[model samples]
Target: MTIIAGVALLLAAVAFFLLPTAHLNTRSLVRVNGVARIVPPETKVAGLAELEGLQTGPGSMLDLTGDVTVLGAGAPAERTLSGRPLDPDGILPDGARIVVRHGDHVLEAIRRVTVQIPYETSVEGKGVIVSLVRPGVPGERELFKGVASGKQAAVFTTSAPQNAVIERTSSAASGLKLAALTFDDGPGKFTQGVLDALAAKHVPGTFFVLGSSAAGNKAMIEKIKAAGHEVENHSWDHPILTKLTTEQIMRQISRTEEVIGGSRYLRPPYGSYDAKVTAAAAALGHKLVLWTVDTRDWETPEVGAILANVKAQTKPGAIILMHDGGNNRSATVASIPVVIDWLFQQGYSLTTVAGLL
Candidate 1:
């Protein structure tokens, strides 16, 4: 064959050998760092990698502990994994998952999340699919060996959240030496219990509705407003304001304003807020109210825990933080009667945030 014809033949041969019969999904990103070498569904690798000895021959014996490469589509890029050449057959195309091991060193690339956890990562797609590969021993956080989409792989990292602690406002909200027992992220399935408790004690509080939650439970939001309580801005989505830009911060709060209407007041989620978030609220002519004391019922579910937090935190004019929504708020609701009776007996009147400020 002529040189040109020979090259064409070789190209055809490689194409026939490497092409996959399936279409690929190419969304999501892959990042690799740290001392641990692992492949996730969001990473990519070439067949010519100088690791696991797959660059030249398909017969290279892999350690198989971390090495999970299989024969698939696309040309393998030339590279090195530790110190061995990767085989062409050992290369994965887009959406392929592979794992490799070299001594104490283990590596893998999963290109997609087998299970997409519904956390506040991004507001895209319906949700994530959780995938289970090999079976594991009962009840262990199964190390997600990998996530694979259509064309890449990555070793997934469980991200730990870093939150800027919100500064406590020292002064209590004004008026009547009244303490506003504000419950945020509420009007959920259990909110009626909180309402009943509050009503029984003849105390009125505030409910800062999250637009997302209120969308599904509008009546609850309406009920709180109707029940002599204050409805304020807690954002459409309960995101940390410190994580958002100016416009996003406004959207977070304003979207809730739209749902709740121009009523008044704003509470940052997780008590997380700053000047920018406060600015967004101010530009819209809303008061940025920070909690003077955190009842932290979201973390500790016991009624005594909730009561301890309240007693330790409450004072004259204190704006107490409690929750009506976002996960199980039963314990918070339970503390209402005891706290109301105690506070009222102690001459602290229970009033809406609007009544106080």
Candidate 2:
């Protein structure tokens, strides 16, 4: 072989041997909740605020904002970099990544720290119930191999009260596409505005009324019902249901039933419920109604953000969650027509929760 050809072969062998070490020097193995992943080397994040912003920004799915626990691999795990324990800033070591753990707060429902739910279903069928009594505590993310046991069990019907019939319809069965809009914690000062918006569009929705609010705002609740909308239960006062005993939960539910006269459905406050809460609600002759699309209107985000969220997430058979009470809901009121117009353009017929079912 020519000397140049021999030299070229020798150089190729040297490069092959160095490739693994070069890769190890530039990439990091990150394990989020024990699932292995990779991040670029030197992917340092400083301060909780920055970390949270990065996690929730466009195109990212991990959220580290709420009550988080951080753990660092190697020694000196207690080190602090940005006013909080541990650090995410600077180059991560080759083959090592920091772990961030936080309670996963689903927008539409309560989530168990240990359980995996495949889809939305009634509380009883899931079997695993999470109570408000034990709130989530942020911990360091650890390696976890989550196993989804199987599909949800079949619905077991019992003798619910005669009045406890939640309306459910099948658009597919009827050859129509339908959606539902639901307002929670209502009968507040802003409710009339919401009603006015819906009225302008000639649209009907479901209102999950709070018993405490209903007693004081009977006229508002009546107005909601009289306007061709459905009025259902959202507890007497909004409390985390899982935090209360069965008796307390019953009281919260039953008192609202008394004020509303009777309800075919119940919406647990904060979307927090477990088996016990569902059982208590079942005895009261009510079915649980949770939302599918959340506007996060309570945060009083920019009106455009509210409208954007609804526009982006609405789907057939979806229950769109908005609020009529608990804050300045003018933004929510503003979003109504925008959402309705877009949905109508998309050929979706808006209806109450019962209508969607």
Candidate 3:
């Protein structure tokens, strides 16, 4: 076969192998063989369904997520996700849910509606708040309360508000080709080595230092900051925040903040936190910072593996998780320069977690 024809056949084979499952209703991503697939959160739903008992036609108004915007029931339009145009008739991804009503009859089958609410306050609020359309339909405000007037607040229906907020924000990352390198449980013997590697690259990273560790390694902590790196909280003893009481959680964060002089960000140990934990962090005016590309360097994996893991998963606006503490991190130290070189070659700007935001 000619080279062009051979290449076309190979492309066709790859597409067939990677085709998504059809008929799966889970999480609204592009389906292939009934299995959920990853799609951008902003992708619009192809067709809007009428309420089960509503007399409205295909043009019936639909409330997508919590945004009071226009949704029409017409032929599908091609749209992009992660920079690629999705199938025109693609079903809505699972990032959001919708609801509609006709008179007293309500048609709501969507799950996890709370994903639509952005928590501007503590996630531990006694009552969750959500935005809803005043009237289920346009011009229907003449019938009842002024809900039809515009957007209004309602009680969110979900048991895990923290998870919903996390899901919502997960897809909200910017399209910038910048990534943040974060070192957790730091101020250790290998910290200086890691810092040296970073210095050679002229890149600054965020170090999630432990309170107890920082207390003993005060000079190292100071050095990290002195070298132009950001210091953040990683709890007092690296306990799981989800299992701790409110007071205990407060202490973990407060003690770290005290030792670090002060911190505006917290990285919960093991990346675990429930609503209560999130609220506690918020109450202290600290933003929760989680990683996107985990180097698994804490496990002290093979040095080559550490470099490979970072190079494979690094992406735009990605937060790369690594470690500068917890026993031998020589592998992590050695991997830094190579990873930084690869990132630079790939056109990524390395910065602190706060800078990525």
Among all candidates shown, the one with the greatest TM-score = 3
lDDT of each: 0.62, 0.67, 0.67
Per-model TM-score, in order, reads: 0.51, 0.53, 0.54
Candidate 2, position 291, lDDT:
70
lDDT of 2 by residue, 1-357 (tens): 699998999998898797766454656665443456566665654533333313432111222222212222112223332334555555445444345444333221122233322222232222111212221222222222212322222233232222111223233313456778889998899899999999999999899999999999788777788899999999999999979988999999999988887887888999886556766887777767777678898885577888778878776676789999888889899899988898899898888876765
Who is ahead in lDDT, 1 or 3? Answer: 3
Clashing pairs in 2: 34-143, 42-91, 44-89, 44-90, 45-88, 45-89, 132-242, 168-357, 169-357
Model 3: residues with Cα > 4 Å off, grouped in runs: 1-173
Top-down TM-score ranking: 3, 2, 1
- Least accurate stretch of 10 residues (summed lDDT) in model 1? 122-131
Candidates ranked, most accurate by lDDT first:
3, 2, 1
lDDT of 1: 0.62
Q: Give a tens-digit lDDT track for model 3, residues 1-357.
A: 699999999998898778864333333454422334455444444442221321232332334234323344322333343345544365465643332222222222232222333232223222111111111111111111123333334444443222323221431245888888889888888889988989998999999999999999899989989999999999999998889887999999999999999998888898876556766787787767777787888774677898888888777888889988888888888888888888888988878877766
Model 2 alpha-carbon miss at residue 350, Å? 0.9
Evaluated against the true structure, the overall lDDT of model 2 is 0.67
